[model samples]
Structure formats: structure tokens, C-alpha cells
Target: MESSKSASDEGTETASKVEVKQDEFSYLEREFTSELFKLEINNLGIFGIGDFKKMLKSLEIDAAKVKTPHKRDCAFICLKSKEALDEAIKKLTGYVWKGKTLSVKIARPNADPYIKRKNEEQQEDSNKKVKRTVESQTVPLAHLTYDQQLEEKDKEMRKVLTAFGNNLRKLNPSFKLRKDEIPCEFEKIKPSPKIDDYRNKSEFAIGRNSNNEIVVGFRVGSYSDGSVEVGEIAKLPHIPSKVKEAVLKFQDFVRQSKFLPFNPEFNSGHFRQLMVRYSEFSKEIMLVPGMYSNNLTEDDVTELKQSLKDFYSDGEGNLVDVDSLYYQHLGKRETGEMFNPVDHLCGKTHITDVIHGLSFRVSPLAFFQVNTAGAEVLYQSIIDLSEPKENTTVLDICCGTGTIGLCFAKYCKNVVGVEIIPDAIEDAKFNAEQNKINNCKFHVGNSDDYIQSMVKEVVYGTLKKEDLDLVAILDPPRSGLHKKSISAVRSALDLKKIIYVACNPKAAERNWLDLCKPESKTYKGDPFRPKKAIAVDMFPHTSHTELVMLLER
Candidate 1:
């Protein structure tokens, strides 16, 4: 009887091991067969999770789960069956959803641990390659012959220009290059005048460096790895020396003080970010100190304010003269409110900068071009490309501080500048008044809303569309214009020319594509074709270059 019981126990153990093995095999198979699709929805304007689900439902796409990893513009859908996934892709790909193009493709199987490991290894290898390339380029060309160095530099410049042209072509295949009214095989690349110290503003974060010492500088790498490097401002050529000195002094003061550097992981400490803005025209400096107000007493605030005043005062350790100083209370919330409840700590409340003979009042939070010299070149190009006539009315969308529109106000009949930031609009108005410019009108609102209202006014006969030759200038943020803005532009019948100034070519390429696409449901009117485009080297020593394209029907 005992022998029989032992045999039964051994049999039970063997069955349990077999069951575990079978479950493991089943999981592996499931990973291999996971039906997931990724959709790169272009011009996904203000789309939330509910909107995405509704769109999927309208298309009869059955998604088990939906994930928006990055921005609301892209979505990942997990379908129950491969057939459903393929059908969804077929129906949505190349289709205009929300007036934007959709790109659908099968997502890589991420359920498999092996696949994740392989991807991580591949990323590390790519990073190593980039590091090696950068290191190789850092070797001074002074060792080579002068002529050889010149040849190498020219070769590198040509390579960059060619790559830029190729990317633009890929983004818009229908776009043709023009050289003196003749179609050219290659687009032109313009060089910037000043390369070093081009940036007018620099923001530094307070953190513990690799040496485990509290420092105020730009972050080098991922914060999770705790690989912050200190005193990097000295190496950056774009940052002015005066700004760097101020940052260094501030770093020292903060380190010596009782206040600690803010740790994002632990959410402790007081110091957050230090912003320095320098004016090339006025030669003035503006300092903005961002700090968290949570867990701070009245005495703590007073002490902090006194410390800042003492640091900037004419004392033994005074690094640079701060023309303006502002204290901003940064909250932990992710809202549109930037620098809530700002207080003027010392000196002036704003700085001044001159662009194309017009002085602009720049608030601490107002959006102004960091590259002051490059901005002059950019504005000149825009004016030349726009060709504003005496009777022409210019519509400047996303006009920060009304610099571009004010420049054109002297040449054009009327200039309407629209900006979303209220402070920027205020600055614009102040600039207009200071400059005694009456032809320009600055509006504080969203570009889309203002554009729609203008279209309505024209339709209602309140504003005669033909009375003034309308020329629209768009200088949107890095994300480019929303689909609604594009639609509003199309709806305007009297818009003769469009001058699109884009800092980020990749994002702007989509807008260009949409504008140039053949007449469809989203775009009912005749499509605008790119007449001329010039690359402005606003940011030198970097791969980024601003492209200004002129489009007309």
C-alpha cells in the first residue's frame, strides 16, 4: 500500500511539470501571433482617446485595446484578429481622417521578451555608432593642409545641403525646384552670417552633477541614469559669456545655501530652472528664476528673494549686471499656464530688442527669436518673398511680439498680427505704440479662431476680400499648423500668396504636402503650389535650418 502511494505522488509531480511547460509554449505562440497595428495619423488635431475610439468604430475596426504612447497625433491599436487589423489598415491608410493623412502599418511584436532585448541591443549599438562619429569629427582639422581642410568643409556642407534637398523632395514629391524661373534639379541652401554665440537665450536646470555636487547647467543625458555633467555652459559657444558667468555664480550661491537642488524622482528641494535672456540690440540681460512654491513658508520666500538680490547687487561676487529679474512660481500641473503668478523681483519687468529698425518689448515669458542676428536675415527674406505692396493687406499668423508684421506694416496697407499668448500680444501692442505704427493690429487669440472669423467677415460682406490683396504669412511653432488652420486658409478665397516660415522642416513638410495635394474632400478649392523656397541657416553648428516657402494658386 505504501509503494502504491509513493508512485501516485511521483505521477502527480510529473503531470504538474508538463502543465507548466505547455503554458510556457502557449505564451510564446501568443506573442508570435499578436495582431497590433500602429497608425501615424498626420494633422491629428486635438484628438483624445474617445475621439480615436469613435473613429475606429465608424470604420468598423474592432480594436481590443488602444494606446497613445506619445502625442495625441499617433495611436496604436491591438486587434483581435489579423484579418481585422489588415482591413483597418487598408481602409484607413492614405485616407483623410480629420483632414490629415493617415499612415498605417503593422506594429512590431513587443510581447516577446527576446524581441525587446534585441531592440534594446540594437539601440545601444546605434548610440555607440553616433558617439564614434561625433568623436571622429571633434578632431581638429588644423592638422590637415589649409586647402585640404577647405575641401573637407565644402564637401560636408554639400552633403548636408543634398540631404536637406532629398528630404524635402521625399516629403513632397510634386514640389519642383526653381532657379530664375527655370526648374532646377537642386534647391538652394543659404549660409548664416554668424555661427557662434547666435543664441540670445539660455535656460539652465539645477541638479546634482556626475561628481555628486549640486550644479546649475544643462542636462547631458537621461535623468534616470543620474549622469548630469556640471559647468557645460562654458563649452557651449552659443551662450554669451556674461550669461555663463551669472549661471556659474548662481550655482555656487545655491550650493552654499540651505536650499537643495530639486530631485524629480523624489520631488523634493526648491531650486528648479534658471533662465537668462540677452538682447543683442539693447545689450541688456533678463534673469528669470523658476521655483516650486509647494512646502515653502513666507520666511523661506523672503530669504530666497533677498539671496537673488544680493547675488545680482554690486558686490564682491557680482558676476554680471542683471537688467531685469522676475520670480516665477512653477506648479507641478501640466497645464497651458506657464509661470503662474509671476512677480517682478528687481529692476525692469521686461527687456528690449530691435529687429529691422523696430524695437520690440520682450516680456520674460514672451516668445522671441533666440537668434537675434538670424532673425534679421529671416525677416528680410520674408519681406522680400512676400513682396507686400502699398495696397496689400498682410495676415501674420502666430506673430510673436509682432516683429514680422510690424516690419511689414511700413510697407503694406494693413497688417493683422494674431498670437495665442496674451503677454505676447500685450508686448506686440506696446511695441506698435512705442514705434508709432498705426497700420498694424495685434489680436490675442488662437490662429484658427481668428482665421475662421476673418473668413466669416469676408463671407458676410463686412470686409471686402477684393479691396485689399490679401497675403497670409504663417510662422507656426515647431509642431506646424493644425489641420483647422490649413482649412481656414483654403476657405479664404482672396488669399493670393502664403509665406510659410517653418523652423522644423519635418513638421512643416506635412503642411506643405496638405497644401499641395490635389482637390479632395478636405480641400475643395484649387491647391496651392510651391513657387519658391529658401533655406535660412538660423541655427548654425546644428543640423536644423529654417525653410521659408512661398505658395500660390
Candidate 2:
């Protein structure tokens, strides 16, 4: 009886290990066979999964999908064989059903279902594990020379910009632009000053490695993909040695601590994220440790913060000079988590970054360029392309810490910078004062709300609106500007030239169209012309490039 009990306990341990390795889909007991196909019906709002089966039966296809909610437009169905899949695709695609065209094809597996805990992001389609592995390479195109990468980027941008120009022509016949003028030239594709170890900031995830031990590094896959394995980032070329060393040391400290790394799947534990910002000029480093506050007393929290300070200030983590330390108690990554409540744990509250010979104070939440050296090259290109004279007033919109505006404030007549974040505005004002730049004025408000009135006040009070040259510098976020904001910028007649800095050109395409589109009730201003555009490689070893588009009326 004793031997049987021991064998039963050993079997239970083996089963638990098997359960740990199972993914989200494994719980559903999904049949991932080749015969499994997803069927999507047209007009599912009126006729849902119930009607989908009826239509399939009418076509003599004996396949039926899994039972789903009443309003589901799509579902996974199992067909007989390969022959049935081909026949179903042939018949269902473009077929008229319920006065709507029915579309059907072989559907890839669904992504991880959205978990409602933190509600940070919807699931990413992790259907193709093989494809995800290839895409996770640090530099998929690193084999190509820098010039070759630039050439490849140029080819892609040329096509995109030319296509946008074509769209402009189609919208208004009066629009006139030569194909050469669409994008400045292939020569204008600016290269980064320093490619490797160029990143000044990195946010390392706090999660378990394959061995289930706490690790400080990049996630092997996204949280939404049901893969939360954290692995070392030593292979990445863009990270500096100082930053890497700090990460390794911090990892050691965390592993030794009594607290456990936060588990997103289980929503329990302490540490969450480690965000490090290193300055190339000042050589100052700011560390903000992000963590989930749960199952810990007030004393526990105090002790944890003290331990971190002691470790970095005098203990093992003292290998690197830690300028500033911040504690970010982000309970959960909820939707609309705009401003993080960061407590200045110890040391200096702000780190200074010198760009274009001007020192700018960066707060824990301020938006500074990740690549400092590359930003200098990009800023110089912007100044060269825009040609702001002594009489020109640069209306810097979405100005974060006033980096772009302050860089060229000496050249321009004056800079009227606007930003939404109050902390960033304060830093911008401080930076201006520290640098003894009195000509510039920074405002704390939405750019769209203040732009039209601000332009009228600055121009009417100082110089004639017609005589003064006004240029608008738009550097909106990845989601791009709202329609109302675009309309507001257009309404200002004094603003003749627009230098749009697009971090995500694809997402920014709508704003570009709104600016250059024919003057309408919705657009509400003189249409601007796309004079020239250029790509700046701000992020190396990635598929992204910053587009600087110069538009004038």
C-alpha cells in the first residue's frame, strides 16, 4: 500500500509539469488537424453561426462549425478533407448571401483570447509560431550593409510617397507636382551617426526564463501571444555595455530578493518591468523599476524600496553609476494609462540630456529621443530642409521636452512650443531657462486648442502676418493626430509650411492626405503641396524609418 501511494504522488507531479507547458489553445482541446478550417459569413449581424451552417448544408457541404455565441461573424469549422476545403473556398468566396457578398477562405488559427485582468492590449495573432520565430530576430536585415539597408528603405519609401502624391493628384486636378519632387532624392535618406549601441533607453520585462527563474530581459514573445518567457538581450547590438551590465546586476538582485517576478497569466507577484534611460552626453543613467503592488504590507513595500536603494547605491548594483532611481507602482497596465504615478525613490529627480549643445532635463515620464546621436543628425536635416530664417517663428506642436524646437530656437525668430504633459512642459521651461534661451515660450495645453489663437496673437502683436514666416512642426504620436486637430492646424492661414515628422508613416498617411486634400468644409484651409520627403533611420535593425515630409502652399 505504501509503494502504491508513492507511485501515485510521482504520477501527479509528472502531470502537473505537462499542464505547465500547455498553451491557452490547449485548454480548449482544439483539433489542429489540416481539415480544420475557419468559416466566415457575410452579414453576421443579421444571420449568425446558426444560419452559417444552414447555408453550408444548402451547398451540399456536410461540414459544420463549432457552436459559438449568437452574434459571431466567424468560426472554426472542420471539413472532410483537402478536397472539401478547395470546394468550399471555390463556392463560398464572392457568393451572394443575404444581399451581401460572402467571403471565405482557409483561416489561420486565432490569437490568444483577450484576458480581462489588466486589459492592457488585445491578443496578437500568434497563429503561426514558425513565422513569429523568424520575425523575432534582432536584425533580420543585418546581413545587408548599412548602405544596402538604406537603399532598401529608400525603394520602399519612394513607392509610398509617390503613391501618396498620386492620391493627391486624383483628389484635386489642380495639384501639380513632378514625380522627382514627390520625395527629395535617394541621397536624402540620412544614415545614423552611430548604429550599434545607439539606444539610450530600454524597458526590460521582469518574467521567468525557461528554467522558471526570475530574469530581467526582453520577452521571447508578447503577453497577448500567450508566451511570457523572458530571455537575455546580450545578443542585441543596439544596447550599450553599461546598460547591459546594469541589467545583469539588477537581475542578480531580483533573484536574491524574497519577492517573485509578476506573473501576467496568474496576476500575482511583485516586480513587473525595469526601464533604464542612459544619456550619451552626460553619461547619467536613470532607473525606474515598475512593479505590481499586491499581497504586500506597507512595511513590505518600504523594505523593498530600501533594499533596491541599498543594492544600487552601496551594494552589488553600485558597479554602475546610478544617477536617479524611481519607483513606478503600476498595479495593472489598464487602458488609457497615460501618466504613470512615479515616486522619486532616491537620488536626483531628473537627468540632464544635452542635444545640439543645449541641456534638456528629462523627467521619468518625459518623451526624449531614444537615439541621441541619430536625433542630432535628423534634427540637422530638418533645419537644413525647412530653411528657417531669423524672422521665422516655428510653431512646434506636440513638443515633448522642446527638443526639436530648442535645437533650432537660436536660428528662428522665436519658438512657440506646446505639449499636453504638464511634467514635460515644466522640463521644457526649465531647460530653456537653464540654457539661458529667453526668446522661446512654452505653453501647457493641447496644440490644436491653442494653435489658431496663438498664431494670431504672436503674429499680430510682433510683425505683420504676411511679412512674418510661420512654419508648423507636427510631431504627433504613433496613432497620429485626431481629425479635429488636423482641421485646427489647417485653419491657421499664417502657418504656410508644415514639416510633419512621422514616426509611423503608415498611420500618419491620413493626416498627410487631410493636409494636402482639396480645400473642403471638412478640411477647412488652403491645401498644402508635398514639396519633398525624406527617410531618417532613427531605429537601426528594425523595419521602421522616420519620414520628414515638407509641405508648403
Best by TM-score: 2
Q: What are the clash counts of all predictions, listed in order?
A: 0, 0
The candidate that achieves the highest lDDT relative to the unseen native structure: 2
Poorest 10 consecutive residues by lDDT, candidate 2: 114-123
lDDT of each: 0.70, 0.76
Off by over 4 Å in 1: 1-50, 53-66, 69-187, 223-231, 294-299, 314-319, 334-341, 455-466
| Distance from true location, Cα of 97 in model 1, Å | 16
TM-score, per-candidate, Cα-based = 0.70, 0.76
Residue-wise C-alpha lDDT for candidate 1, range 117-153, written one tens digit per residue = 3335454655464321211222244255534544454
**Can you write out model 2's per-residue Cα lDDT over 184-235, one digit (the tens) per residue?**
3434678888888888888999977766666898887766644677888777
Pick out the ten consecutive residues of candidate 1 with the lowest summed lDDT.
18-27
| Model 1 score (lDDT) | 0.70
Q: Which parts of model 2 have CA positions greater than 4 angstroms off?
A: 1-16, 19-138, 176-187, 294-297, 332-337
TM-score of structure candidate 2: 0.76
